[model samples]
Target: MQRRLIASVLLGHYLSAFTALGIPLYLPRILADLAPDAPLWSIGVLFVLPTLCTALAAPLWGRLADRHGCRLSLLRAHLGLCAGFLLAGFSPNLALFVLALVIQGTFGGAMAASNAYLATQLDKDGLARALNWTQYSARLAMISGPILLGLLTAQGLGLELYRWLAPLPLLAFALVLPLPADRPRRPARAAGSATTNIRLPGDLQRLLAVQFLFSFAMVVTFPYFVPYGEGLGIANDALLGLLYSLPHGVYLLALPWAQRRAANPLGVGLALLALGNALQFAIVQPEPLLALRLLSGAGMLLAFVGLHRCLSQRSRQGGAGRLFGWYDASGKWAGTVAGVSAGLLSQGYGIASPFLVACVAACAALLLARPLVACPRELPA
Candidate 1:
């Protein structure tokens, strides 16, 4: 049963990751199909709109999951994803494509739901391991999804086929159906529970803020890397795809080492992130940029795993869904802001400016993470 549960969770993570990345991976191609003459800045708006919707919707879904059940929430999210992707695939114009993305965001809370469900089944150590593995799956998807989409687009398969692949998550949802169900944890006093205020710890709040900054920095720079590389006179699609994926590949490779570190992993991760982003300003050549991207990927993965582990430890008391929802919202909101900012900054300054902005944001996060680093580690429950 445990093996089956783990398998199901990992599979779900992979599918979810695939669905999340599929569109963005082929955004350039999709944009060409929707609007051949669209400016690079418009791409950022495409990202911003859906992420803004997600920022608004994720918390609601999380609260619903806490009141109801994680499984039901997961199922609903997957179905929504299916419908959203199908709508995107059939979309005739950029406006309709944007609407499909909004639908996707409105119905999407699967990542938080999955994490919340797994939290119920695992102790601190197990939860950390599960979360890291899930992150690993996501990183793997990030690596493969773009390359796969690139290859398919090259083969004349078209970007719509990728959008049509939304059923993958639905299949994953079906796979999860036989896994043990988790009932929502009802508070001791129902009426009081509904009315009572729950506050997050100072450390968690700081951590979430740090997460927002880091996410903002990442989202701001990530979508523009292709254009940045193109500006550098490297137009080979495969090489560009590899360049974009290098960080995630390195991130996936670095997860186990991150999971093993005991002392100030978050600090270490943040420092690495700071260093990697700072180096981006110096590296203009393709080879050096690739190496720097790899470094950034490893650092970002370590930071992510450390932060998520901290969140899982704190959320063990209950309401995991709600907490993860807020966590997701924080990142999504940050991404929303970053998306718009990416467009403006790139338009006003230059394409490479976002990387410098990312570097500063990462340094800020590193400073904010100091309090978390000082807290004594807790044992698995």
Candidate 2:
């Protein structure tokens, strides 16, 4: 039963990842079609809009999930995605398109929902493993989604892909429907349960700080990555897409080993991320830069997995739905800020400048890493 539930969650996440992570890749194209005269900064703002909405909305959803059930929250998110995509696909004007993005961001947050649901069933170690596999699903999507988008674009499907992508969440919605209900029973809690008033522990606070910084460092590089590659003179779209996804490939292939061998995954991962981003800014050559990106990918796996492990340890203490909600919001907020910063940096400095900024953020996050690895004492079961 546990195995089946885990599989369902992972598969659901995999399906949702296409829209969450992959669709953003085509934002530039989508903008070109929908709002041809949109300014350069608009892409950055638009790219992060959904994320900002998610950050603001997730905690409220989390509170609802804590009161109701995570399965319902998860279902709601999928449906939200379906609606958001359809609206965006059919949008006749830029204002409507922007509204569609707002709806998308406001409603979609399946990853947090999935995490909360899994936390209800799994032990700390099991939850960690499940979260790791969830990341695997996302990484796999990161690799395949772009390649597929590139192929569809080559066939001249063009912006029609948005319409094609609309049904993906419906498929995910169907996939998650089979999982058993995971809400806490009404009888189990007092009438005035303080689910909404739960406070973050010191360790979790540190981790959230790390999450924000780490997310900012990583995401700031996303907005201009393809353009940066083009600036480096790598013109093959397919090859550029592959290079962009190489770090995730490293995560899929190397994470298991890092999980077993790393003494302090968070710290080590941050250090590597800082190093990789620094190298990316320093080195302009495509060949060596590709290899160096793997270093950053390796760091991503360790840091993220380590963070999840710490989170799992804390989930039961504060209620998974609320805690994961806050965590997701933290990361989303970071992505939002990073997007704005990336736009400003790219406009003022250069496309490559975000990588340097990312390196600095990663280094700053390294300062908060000690609490994550050291706070493993058992909480109330």
Candidate 3:
């Protein structure tokens, strides 16, 4: 039972992780198809679509997770996302492509089920650490998914390949069938209400705000980054992939350490995210380039891992999946706005303008959490 539940819960997340990374691998292709002549500023709006869907739909999804439990959520979302991604493979028009992405976003809420499953089932102290490890699976997927997509891209795999990848979520839904049902308890306010207010409890509100600010600040690149790199003498899309991976590498390296040492661990997460954003704002010349990007990625790793751990620890009774649903949803929403704004800002001003915004947003988030950073719990967890 334990093994099945653990695997079932863990497997769905691993699948989601790959899908998240895989989208970027095909980003260049998506860009070419939509706007061969489009300015780099357009990338920000592209980044926003799924994010907007997630932002709009998360609380409702959380409520759904509370009602349907992990199994139904997975089953229902499996069918929807299956349709969504399958359609994405065949989207001839840019509008259809955007619609497909939105559909994918709507079903992304299935992740709430996975989090609730973990929060309800895992032991405390032990679970947060374990959750960190689960997150590590996502980083690991970053290593593999891009490489896989790159290989496919190199071989000229196009829409057909996406059609093939479309089955993965369905397969995941099938694999998790063995995981036993765990109907986690929820606060009456969180569960029974017909409407889910965007406003939440104070702690949840703070956490959500931090997540929003964190993603918002970092999203300045969107489509503009490739051009930024091109200006910096980057050769192709592959380098961009490597740049994305560099941040994850730093993040994976920081997780265990941050999980162990950071005070007001969640606050540390916000601070690290701030530092990363600040670096982008600070560096104008490409002379100190590689090191600055690396440092920023490390900062992000710390912030994200810290925040995940804090949320997992705090939601011991209400169920991990449910709490995570809110976390994932809020983060996605923020990411959407950031992506759009980044693109528009680049279009309206220069690419450099977005960095200034990133720095400002990140700093604000860090300050918000400063008062709380001093209270981190000790680590039997």
Candidate 4:
């Protein structure tokens, strides 16, 4: 029973990670196919809008997890994702594509729901392990999603297939819902539908800020890397996907180790995230190289794993659902901004610039993370 619960949580998080990365992985092909006529700015907007929707919807989903339960909420969110991404495959215009993305974005709470479920079940040590597993799942998805999408697209599937692919993960996710609802006295009140009942604490404002800064620094790389690779003579499609997946592949392998050692997970994540960027900076030659990016990916995984562990620790209160919603919201918003900014900048300066900016952003986050380091909760008291 315990092992099943852990598997469900891990698989659920992996599925959500697959959903979250779909756009960035497929966006270029999507724009070329569906919105070829749209301006670069408009394409960027289509990218940002869904993330914006996720940012808005995460809080609601988080609360829904609190009032009802995370498992059911996970099922509901997956249903939303199935519908949204399916529509995206058949979307004929930028507007409809944007609509599908918003739908996907709104359902992005699958991760939050999974987290809330784990938070409720796991004690501190358990929560830490569960979240470490969650990080591993994300790295696996990041590696797998692109490779899978690339393969599917290779068979003339193009990018629209995400529409169909999106539904299956959630459908699989729904299979695990039984564990959380052992008693099954579900709320039927309309007011309790998707909105959260738990309130976020005002005192944790600084924590949220640190979370936001960390995500902001890291998210800037999403939309720009593929295009950057293409520009730098990465002509083989398989190689391109490999280049993108390598860093995450390395990260996935190391997550368990990091979870064991970090005393202050968030602070450690922030500092390492900054250092990861610096490593990227160190590789900032005149062009983008796949090998260097792989190294960067390893650094990113370490940093992001730390960040997630910190947030898991922070979300241990009764308002955990609310906390997760806000945490996810910040990451979504930060990614949206970074994706758009990278898109615009890529229209001119090329790929090295976005990563360079990532380095700077990480430094800023490190400065903010100092307080978290100094005042960690689980100190040797």
Candidate 1 has its poorest 10 consecutive residues by lDDT at: 192-201
Each prediction's RMSD over C-alphas, in Å, is 3.1, 2.8, 4.6, 5.1
- Model 1 sits at a Cα RMSD from the real structure of 3.1
Best by TM-score: 2
| lDDT, residue 374, model 1 | 69
Candidate with the greatest lDDT versus the true structure: 2
- Between prediction 2 and prediction 3, the one with superior lDDT is 2
TM for candidate 2 is: 0.90
Better of 2 and 4 by lDDT: 2
Predicted candidate 2 versus true structure: per-residue lDDT over 1-381, tens digit per residue: 889889888888888888777778778888898789999778878878999999999989987777788888899998898888899888889899889889988999988988888887888888887888887887898888877887887786655676898888889899889888874533254467845334445466787899999999988998688998888878998788777788888889987876675455888888999999998888777777677878888888888877777777677733677788888999999988988898799999988999999999999898877756776644564
Comparing 3 and 4 on lDDT, the stronger one: 4
**Model 1 Cα lDDT, one tens digit per residue, 85-130:** 8888888887788888889889875677778778767777788788
Per-residue CA lDDT of model 3 for 1-381, tens digit only, reads 665676766676677657655766576676686557767645545656666786677667666666556466666665666777888888877778778878987776555556656665676655666577666777777688878877787877765555777787777778766666766444445566774322233466677777778877766654467676666666667766667567778767777676776454555555555565556556656556567678677667676666666565466534444566778777777776776687689878876677678777778878776543444432221
Model 4 segments more than 4 A misplaced: 31-36, 90-94, 182-203, 226-241, 265-269, 282-295, 344-351, 378-381
lDDT of each: 0.76, 0.82, 0.66, 0.66
Q: Report backbone clashes per prediction.
A: 0, 0, 6, 2
lDDT of the structure predicted as candidate 4: 0.66
